[model samples]
Target chain A: MIEHLPALIIAIPLFGAFIAPLFKKKQSIAAVWAILITAITVILSLMLMYQVRLHGIIVYVFGADKPTIVLPSGYKVPIRIMFEIDGIGAFMAISATLMSFVGALYSYSHVKAESGLEKYYALLLLLEVGILGMVLTGDLFNLFVFLEIAGIAGSALVGFRNYRGEASEAGIKYLIVSAVASLMVLFAIGILYGEYGNLNLAYISRQVSLSTLDMIAFGLLFASFAMKCGSVPMHYWVPDAYTEVPAGINPVLLVSTYASLYALFRVSFTLFANVSISLERVGWIMSVLGVLTMFIGVTMALVQKDVKRLMSYHAISQTGYMLLGVGVGLTVLHNSDALAEFGRTAMAGGIFHIINHIIYKSLLLMTAGALFYVTGTRNLNEMGGLARKMPITTLCFIVGAAAISGLPPFNGFASKFLIYESSYRLNPLLAVFAMVTSILTLASFVKVFASAFLGPPLEKFENVREVPRPMIVAMVILALLCILFGLFPDVVLNKIVYPAVDALINVAQYQSWGGLA
Target chain B: MISKLVTGSGYWSPLLWLAFLILFTLIGYVIYSRGNPSYKKESEQVKPYLSGNAEPSKEKIQVRASDIYWGFIEALKEYYKVLQAIHTGDVRDYILWYLGVGTVILFLLVGGA
Candidate 1:
């Protein structure tokens, strides 16, 4: 039963997406189906994670052929498009599902106010299907296919409220950029095939011999994924697109970015594990970009009048931290023989931050959504003293704020602490820059909290009331999870983080899986 | 060997050239700013005389955000147009275009392989 959890996770939402359109005129029925689908997917993802932890790696083939092939070196590779689960994939899947679940829960009341509820729910489900498939797929081309699905779905969802010119414009911009990025990725994949004729990740990993072609392919692929992940220079589209999307859709968009960034690591490390890919270059590029991204993103966030845009910039900044962790790991991988251990530390930190980002960022987006639900605006300057009228919303928003700012005993701090500690051990300068960025982030969120929630009551919001129970329930669950993950970092580390780390560092494991030595 | 070295060095040359170009721009801007009396006199600054009486407003004379990078974005506007042109409100056109692109990519992959 557990063995088929991977397929089930993807299938439920997919089936729901198809079924949702049939209930086009029946909004209530569609909502119930979407909820049921998301709930089942979340439970399945949890169970899958448990199974993967109990076992080593849950490697399931789509269409199995020979059991395993013995190479000249007697290493056996499984012959199929594998849906291999390690800690990272499991954790990402769970976080994505959980957020989707919460987002759906919050949407019942929030989405009731909007028109085209059918298309909205259907696109959301399709977006989930793409995300799940991207996380689970082991083939590079399959990953690209899933990437396209996710990108198109995201753009459609972003432009869901197409009446607004800004939404349409932002969605168009996102679409163009996404298309170019995908093309570049496809070109890189072409180069890889030319160099080593394989599309399966394991095969590529086995056959990858360092060359100019390999390096160029790495650069192109990395750059494309970096753009998709909203890293420094290529991040201009994120804030506009995220902010312009209908309020309920913000969390969905954030999760899409989260999933894509994880895809970057998953694909990159799997393919380029052993090549002399210049970790120093990769590190400097990522860390420098990360520092600038964090600084610029947070600074821009500070002066933003619109709460959604502010949170959007902060999303860009959070990507910076994750990049910094990965960069530190890459840097250490080259300079020292303790590469695997230290790299794991950095990767673990990065993965932890990714999970933490999903929780807090969604909560914050939901905060924005909740505000929009009542006040009909996302501008923080227009909001004030909502702490009295919308106490639960304000509390949830504060928890989100605290987590994002990386304050003590919050999920953000735990993951960020690991990133900082690991980077400090590798290179203290990056560590320093990371610290500064963290402080700036804290400052920006503080400004948001102060301006939006803490000031004297605005006359406009005088009659504003709290959102319904379901939305509150969603926020409360996320807030509690934030604290839970923060307090029990070791539990998360032991079950999820460590196994992912082990999988990443173990080249032999990859080689064995790919039938290459 | 010569081609490899040339290609390798070619990458850095542009970066170096860019550095110099930026430095020159900075120096020019500084000298211009220093020499021009209008730079210091914010109150006296008027919209550049464009053969007509410039309208007065409280806003400072600065390029709007959209206008600042209009050229770069305008260059890419064609792709956006192409995308928007495909918005025929028909799902069939989108599928056809996707099929076309996908076929090209697949051909490239197989042929390149």
Candidate 2:
């Protein structure tokens, strides 16, 4: 039973998604089913994370003679699909599952009033399956498959309120871009498959000769995944999609964005693990892109009036921090001692930021949703003195805003501190710009807090009240996490981040899982 | 100490930071309390006033969120022009930008390699 846990993790939510429509008329019942299934998925993911923590990497081969069937002595390649659940994959899976679980809970209140909830829950589960599969699958094509599933489900869910032309418009844009990006990924995979006859990541990594075509394939894969992750210059669709989606789904969708970022890291660090691809040069390109993403995203965020759109832009900016950290890690890979010192710290900073960003960004988005719930307005100009009316939501927003701005004693500060301190050693400019971005982030959120929550009370909102109980509970879970993760950085860093970093930078660990040893 | 992270370059211990924050805040409060330490909550005194003049009604005095950053926006007008021009929100423009970024990445990674 334990041996089958990997496949079961993906299967359970999938089966639940398929069975969801059976309770279509009973939205409440379907909601309960969704929550129950997602809770089980979360438990399974935690167990998997724990097991991976105890043991280094647990490889599960599918449809083989026994689950861990070693290939025959003559056949060196692995033909069957497999799951390589290392610390990094498990960490990301745990994040994806936790966010999805909270999302499912929040959806009970957020989507109950809306129609077609059965489809909503189904799409939500499928979305999780996609992200989890991308992070967990050992095969490259399987990543592409999951990428498409997530894109389709995300697009459909984005337009869940099709009657609103805004949502439908955003959904269509998402679908078009998602399809184009997915095709590019498929094309890149095709190039690699043509060169090397296998689609398994470990197999390709072991045998990657890095021909001219292979380099082009590498470029294609990076571009596609970067686009999917909402990197700058390619990030216009982010504001539109994030603003139009249901609030509860935004946090989970945010996970999908990070999944793409995870894909970016995996392709660079794992798929092209050998010397042929020139890690330093590729890493520099990513770092430059990261700087551009950071500056452009924050500058644009500074002037936005719609509260949700502003947060989305900030989300793009935060992604820049991760890119910078990991990019530096990639840049310094040629130096073993440096990789051990600054590079590992940079990578840890990037990965730790992923956890921190999920906690605070989702809470911020939910708070924005709570404001929109009671006021029916996403415009900040229309808001005034909400702090008095919705004290809980306002408090959550303050915590979220402070954390996101990298204030002291919050999760963002701890993660950003790591990135800034380590990346500075690599290049002082990287650290300076990161700190500058942090200040701008604070300014941006202060503008939000002042306009939306502070100032004189509005007569129109005199009778307005706090958000629903479920939504508040959903937010407080994250808010408390913001405090805990902020105040206890050492715990997460030692226990979670280091192991995940090990899973990433140590190519030998991944290769050993491929039966190379 | 609990909740502390140490790297090669520096260390962050929230316990110590929190302790200092509490200490400083207490001293500041005590010092400030030596002056006007207490206030009465009177609705009439809480109304907005500007330069010893009666302020406009709250509705009339409402500041548009967009207006909050006018000074910053004015100083960076040219920079914002480029940003806004690039972010035209049109499909063709964004697609072209995507292709352009991909092209640059291809040259940098592949060409250099």
Question: Which numbered prediction scores highest in DockQ against the true structure?
Answer: 2
Report, for every candidate in turn, its global Cα lDDT versus the true structure. Answer: 0.72, 0.88
In order, the TM-score of chain B in each prediction is 0.35, 0.77
Question: Highest lDDT: which candidate?
Answer: 2
lDDT assessment of candidate 2: 0.88
Candidates, DockQ = 0.02, 0.69
Per-residue lDDT of model 2, residues A151-269, tens digit only: 99999989998989999998998998899889999999999999998898888888876577878888899998998899998999999999999998998899999999999999999
lDDT of 1: 0.72
CAPRI tier of model 2: medium
Counted clashes in each candidate structure: 0, 2
Off by over 4 Å in 1: A65-80, A334-342, A514-517, B1-113
- In angstroms, give how far residue A109 of model 1 lies from its true place: 1.4
The positional error of residue A80 in candidate 2, measured at the CA in angstroms, is 0.5
Clashing pairs in 1: none
lDDT of 2 by residue, B37-94 (tens): 3555675556566357877767667776888989999999999998888887777666
